[model samples]
Target: MLDVGSGTGALTRVLRAEAAGDVVAVDADPKLLDHVEGPTVVGDAFRLPFPEDTFDLVICQALLINLPEPVDALREFARVSRDGVAVIEPDNGSVTVDSTVGGESALAGQAREHYLAGVDTDVTLGSDAESILADAGLDSIEVTRYDHDRTISPPYDEADVESARRKASGDGLATDRETMLDGGLTADGYDSLRQRWRQMGRDVIEQMAERTYERTETVPFYVAVGQV
Candidate 1:
């Protein structure tokens, strides 16, 4: 088995534990590959260094969402794997957020719209992986959906307190402003969005001060597998 873009070897470790074979971790970052157990290779997803059909399976997680050319990586994965290829990615467009704080949910929705519109990469490709795999000339394509539930509730922990503190600082809003700008948002548009985001963040912090802040998020991920 081969794990491409195996940052910190998270997926590689899982494959090592569940499967009965050596899992080779391939990453462009040598610092990350240094910690990976068993064999590790420094390689790019665009051009894997190994020969054709070098591994029985090739897998990646949370990689395609950030890549400019996901299909190119898929084609390379197919080229390296004799049996199958799998990619796990998130559907940022389908994310759902529920918050007890007033205005927080609406704010999240607005942010998501701008994010989907401005981002250069196909952030929604998790749901479209099947079609992408088919385009890559793979056969017996399969798609599996997984929903990750993240909840923030009462009796706040240290992390929650720190998170609320950070929200009050508007750091998240600042980061979003930068991302939106990089994604082609105009200066005036970013100012408008930032105003709303900061307002919502302040409201959230106020709710946290009253010990009433609670939120949950559902992020959908898809695993697309195909035979080479």
Candidate 2:
């Protein structure tokens, strides 16, 4: 099995333990590859350093969106795999962040939009994973949809909000920390958007837990599998 762009061996660890054959984890980030336990290699996704048909199965998660040339990377995966390949990626186009105040603060909204836009390359073909595999000459293509949702309770303090704010700022989504804090909706605004998300999270959790909140917040993903 081949785990491409296996960050921190999150999936690689599992594959290493479960698969009978060897699991080779590859990634461009040497830092992430350093801690991986299994047979690991640091390499570019576009140009994998492996012989043709070297793997029976190849699995890629949250990778396509980050690659500058996803199609080329897909072709490489297909080239390396002799039997099959599986890909999992988030559907950014379908991503929605609910807020109690109808919508998030303008800054928060812009930040979210920027975050999504920043990874456009990764998700450009998000909705077309199967098509990608087919175009690469893989057969028996099948696509499955998965949705994951999580909610946090009580621990929702100012720190948590601040942490999220920091992450958003650091991620280059927001222009600056102050803008987010000030609720100015500028790249620099740094006002707490926590209350808004907290309320939204609570509503979602209640609805999901009590079965009364018919509306659900979900993150959709696509899993495409095919035989080479």
Candidate 3:
């Protein structure tokens, strides 16, 4: 099996544990691949280094949406897979976020809207994977929907604390300022939103101090598989 775009080997570790044969992970960043335990290759998705029909299955998770040309990447994946190709990608448009903090969800939606608008790639392309595979000339396409639910509540961990701190500092939103601006959000509008976002973050911090803070986010992921 070939795992394309296997950053940090998260999925690679899982595949290695279950697969009957070898699992070779390939990524563009050697720094991320350095963490993987077994065979790893530094390569691009569109131009995989492997020869034709090298693996029984070629798969990627949360990768295609970031690419400028997903169809071309799928075609490349098909070139190396003797049997099939699969992609696990999320539908960002369908994501649901809830928080006990006042106005958090609304503010998050606004931020997401701007980010999506400015983002160059299709972040919500999970549902279109089937058709994309078909367009790439792959047959026997199949898709499965899965919901990834994340909840944060009592007994906050270090990571949760760090997230709250970043929010309170408005650092997270600040990072996306350029993207939001490019997405058509006016400077004044962004300032106003950032002010409110900081307030929401403060509220979140207060609630956390009382151990009452809670948040839930659900992202829908699609597992699209096709025969080469």
Residue 93 lDDT, candidate 2, scale 0-100: 60
Which runs of model 3 end up more than 4 angstroms from their true locations? none
- Runs in model 1 deviating more than 4 A are 182-184
lDDT of 1 by residue, 88-142 (tens): 9999999988998777777778777776777788998999999999988899999
Worst 10 residues of 1 by lDDT: 164-173
Winner by lDDT: 3
* lDDT-based ranking: 3, 1, 2
Tens-place lDDT per residue, model 3, 1-228, is: 999999999999999998889999999999999899769999999999999999999999999999999999999999999999999999998888989987998899999999899999999999898898999999999999999999999999998988898888899899999999999999999999999988888999999999999999999999999999
lDDT of each: 0.86, 0.68, 0.94
lDDT of 1 at 75: 94
The count of residue-pair clashes in candidate 2 stands at 19
lDDT-superior candidate, 1 or 2: 1
Model 2: per-residue Cα lDDT over 1-228, one tens digit each: 999999899889887778798999999888998889858998888888999999999899889877777767888988888889899887766665443323434434555554554443656466889888888778899998887664434445565454444443443333433433443344322234443444444444444344443322456788999898
- Stretches of candidate 2 off by over 4 Å are 99-102, 105-110, 114-124, 156-217
